[model samples]
Target: MTDLDAIPDDPSALRAALLAMRAELAAERALRRGLEDRNERLQHFIRQLQRMQFGRRSEALDPDQLNLALEDLEQAVAEADAEAEKADPPRREARARERRQNRGTLPGHLPRIEVVIEPPTTICPCCSGAMHIIGEDRSERLDVIPMRWQVIVTRRPKYGCRACGSAVVQAPAPPRLIEGGLPTERLVAHVLVAKYADHAPLYRQAQMLARQGIALDRSTLASWVGTAAAELKPLWRLLRDDLLGSAKLFVDETPAPVLDPGRGRTKTSWFWAIARDDRPWGGADPPAVVFTYAPGRGHAHAATLLKDFRGILQTDAYAAYKAVAGAAGDEAAAGSADGGVLLAHCWAHCRRRFYEVAQKRPAPIAHEALRRIAALYEIEAEIRGRPACERRAVRQARTKPLLDAMRPWLEQCRAQLSKKSPLGEAIGYPLNQWEGLTLFLDDGRIEIDSNVIERSMRPIALNRKNALFAGHDLGAENWAVLASLIETCKWHAVNPEAWLADVLARLVSGWPNRRLAELTPWAWKAEQDALHRAAA
Candidate 1:
């Protein structure tokens, strides 16, 4: 009415009016958006609280009603405490086992029998004619010696022929487990086991050794692990080749410490694992499992480890893996491996993020996803230890539908939810890993999660937690080999201590090429079993 545009030459008044109106509009919109996001997140948390409080219902949960129950809150807190306890170093479990082991000795070459001795006869000298034996007296018990470390000196004698001025030479000495290295095969194995299996840190290991009267230092022990790893590189390569050649593999990664020689700081090392099967593929020949160490979480390392990998590669949805997938596609297109890399997504990994956010917002989508996945796992449980064909059939008939149903639901939730929210993040991360997640669905050979490899990685994680960061790169890589061997033995149901001792004895005997494969956990296990049967 006042012809404001024509009067807008008054810049101060125009600007102030525009700013005030814009501020009011922004405030109103911001208030509405904030409430929507809060409600969304809260809704997710409530749903989680309900699921934790009540036995899970097949029907979806309502976020609004979830807050009405304090029982859910109490139950979830208990669960969180339980998880925290689990996250702790498994030292208590190890302590229990150690106590059990201490209570009973193995059937060693030495006998564990105890003999009772009657006390010497006692009577007055004057009444010696009626001497009588006294009650048995207490005797000192025998004490077992602690573990002692000593260097074995192996000398090769030279020979010469006196006749015709002819000279004779003896065969050369075989390489030591560590050339010019002071540690014994047993010591190396002990250090490896302590670090990986026992999760004992190097410094702690040094202390343990000291108690055994061995004056070893952590720095020195670290070197032993590195050198031993170098010696085992060939075995790691062989394992990697075998894993890639397999038709199915379950793979995962966890963080590792790598000392940067130049920077003097520990860099992040991801332990990448490729395993064929976890719960016994139950085939005549077991699938191979391999582990590799890389400094960066990049595709190049994966590309190298899987250079000839034409078979199914099961893994989680890490972006680095996608690059690997892209590279594998290129390789396949170029007829490199001659087969394509199939993707398998881990429903557990996908469910876990949602579960985490569900702590804040118990969203139905997360709980429902977990329920659906649980059903698939239940089917797997029902078909436990079944052959691939049988498992595939069961999964196809039952589990496939759950997967099919999950995809559309994920898509709808992704669309309906705010992109910025944690629910979106939780859903998107696994969805991104979708390529790997969906791999098992396409093929029966694939598994639900990359747990096979992840299980193998647990020992490493346990060891890392105890030992802390590795002292050096070589030490970390060495750990990878030892872990590969130990984990592989475990996977094949082989006793690690036995397999390790046997392999160490053989390898230190010059790593017999004709019998090197037998040094592998899987191979050595068979040999050990065969010998046991023969002796029996």
Candidate 2:
């Protein structure tokens, strides 16, 4: 270290002093650079948080319904607090309190419990007269009893033939999902819904059961889930087959980690989501999604899963999908052969690449591209509910010209920007996948993006975030099976718990395989609604 006071005020003396402390100065500069880099990362993280909490969710810039709901709840809470303050004045608030007492009406369907409070004396205070009841103040309070366990005792008397003495008669036990297991169909369904739908892990669920004096081990719950998955797999298979049979399908994949016992860590697995939703294009087929778990994210797995298909496949620019397309041979590229799958890439994915670049830097080129793409979505919003033919004609007339103009603009920008840069990569994406990206121009039934299947992956993402990882590959497969049905039930706006309960009961009661289609979410919802109407 060189002291400034000891150094002379001459150029040569200062130069000599600087030379002596160059190593320390260099280290100080290096430390400053490191701190600056860390500061940049922390700032970037803060921007991400701001965007997530306040930024527009979709490319369309549609208003968030969740925010609207939150506003309504806040207004309700404010009003409640105001009411509570006004009610503090005992003399002036009696009438207002009386009006507010029964403001909320409980449903007539719920059973009521009554508690009568009589006067302390049957005489009036002013007069010494015995009085009959004139009026009564009745206040109803809703009550709930937590889940209680009960033992179901089935008494089946046995009788023998008295005269013949050769025959024996006994009532047989009813068919159950678990033949000898104590849980009923509803109980098994409850466990399934709790784990897959509610995102409750088995160990946590076991503790919850223990709180109710039902001391079941986590392994027991896991066994029940495995058995239920095996039983319910037929329905899942039927759903997948039905979805694949459709003419158009949206496909996407998300990572799922499976525990590796040998390595004492987790291995990366994949959950491939295949969906068929024609309502967006005015087709008559019901919307359905099916998820399949695989040991790896490879083209062979996708090819095998889609081997029986001859339809348009919508997906992102994953090389695996392209490999699958190539392996099917060049002839099947058009999807006209007996077994072919045509690729239709997602525009949302293309926009997302540039959106990230634009968020990070002020890229005018990316913004321009986004503006042009937004115009196409504006046209889509206008003609959404129209017939497929009408939609096709509109896209050809309006959207085609913008896309034609965008291609050359993208190419010209790519020539000027670095090929490895984010903007340049975004420009190159559409150029490489041009045919697939523009598939919507030719077909009216195909969507502009594979957003439907991506939307279906959110539940899996949330569940994985909560549970961290599945116990094993088989456990992940079971997760896929149960999650498929539960998510499908949500897609059809059916209560998952109710659907699972009804489906499990039906299976235990010997639901025929031929009528398996009737057990699907849409069909089951119709049946339940019909039965409710009949009962009403």
Candidate 3:
């Protein structure tokens, strides 16, 4: 029976029955809304899965490929337009005049080659007289020259004295990178740059050389790489020391695969990267990065890599890093000037968790968290490149209040969620690392994320992708050594090829070990700049 049928006839009883019916209706509406919300979330989750499985693999074409396709299309259109204009003389005249007027000049740095075109005869068509030059329209297009291989020959002559006959004199030959071997230091540098910086494997380089009829074996190229890496190890150590000496740095690691010949399979390794870029705060230190390869990713590995490093270490919320921070807490508590490392966690990581939740389902809490984090990053953008003191003051004045409100709000939201829920876990991440996440408010030198070191890992990733796996642990270590110097050169905007070429030559000439700092990318760039200014 309906509730109305069970109602009493008395006036007060009827009013109570109506109230009971209204309460039941409201409860039913709430339950229906909850079910609808859950259904909507499930729908979104399914759609996300479907998209992942069936969508285009990549969001966009590779930049280089896109540019090449555009170049071809532009050329084809130009050719077609030219043919059309040629079929009509008046259109040809109009188009030629417009094209010449609209043409852009190439860069001035490129060497210019001039070509002069003249009529069949140097006489005017109207009269049999010589034509004089008028204002000439000039246009420029870019060009390229293919790589050329050459050999250098050195000879030392000896002469015996006529009277003495025992005395002989000869000049000493210049130093060679490969003793009694064919390749020069410059060639070795090229191989290093191509393999490490350009991500071309030794076998591919050997094939390229073979195409040119050089016919060098892959093992020979590998030996040259190993030799160069041995010579460059000291520079890599110096770079590591230079970065560790800084008070603040970014540290991160990525997996590297090495072939396990005994098992005929691959084993996972790690490349630990430490980097510093103080340009954002107007600090004078030039940017640098050094990568160290380890057999495993463990707390012990991090401790060894950052053994003497003290001060702010920015990184993702990896437990290994947290372990390092915990170990250093003792010295920090003692108030030592060179205290243990203070962990400054990445906000990007925190935001990423929320982003994943929001993308998969209807998550107002995650979305709100992301919006608030974005506001903090916005303030960072405005204060970038300002003095550290000013940055600190601005963060304290502006960013602190937002973070202050966000902390309690996040806690309150998490209280309403089940701990096992995706949104709950997203909220828990930042809360777990609250201290490290908020540490940036006190120090201006620290970045909001460890993207500096993360950026340095991309080349390593590319090399791994191309080469598949390193032969063994030792080969992986060599990869670390060369990658360190090559990436540092790139950070300083120094041409890796040119810097490696010059430094390899100097090392072969027995450059002083104590003065290895002079050969670092930044120092070498400074010296080059000074010479250029003097010449100017």
Indicate which candidate wins on lDDT.
Answer: 3
Using TM-score as the measure, what is the rank order of every candidate, best first? 3, 2, 1
Candidate No. with top TM-score? 3
Q: Which stretches of candidate 2 lie over 4 Å from their true place?
A: 1-151, 158-170, 329-339
Tens digits of per-residue lDDT, candidate 3, 48-68, equal 334433445442333332322
Clashes of each: 18, 0, 0
TM-score of decoy 2 = 0.70
Q: Could you give candidate 2's per-residue lDDT for residues 402-436 as a string of tens digits?
A: 99999998889999999898888998999999999
How do the predictions measure up, each by TM-score?
A: 0.64, 0.70, 0.72
Residue 370 of model 1 has an lDDT of 71
List the RMSD of every prediction in angstroms.
27.0, 26.7, 32.1
Tell how far residue 462 is off in model 1, in angstroms: 2.3
Query: If both were scored by lDDT, which would come out higher, candidate 2 or candidate 3?
Result: 3
In terms of TM-score, how similar is model 1 to the real structure? 0.64
Candidate 1: residue 119 lDDT (0-100): 22
- Superposed model 3: Cα runs more than 4 Å off: 1-146, 159-166, 332-337
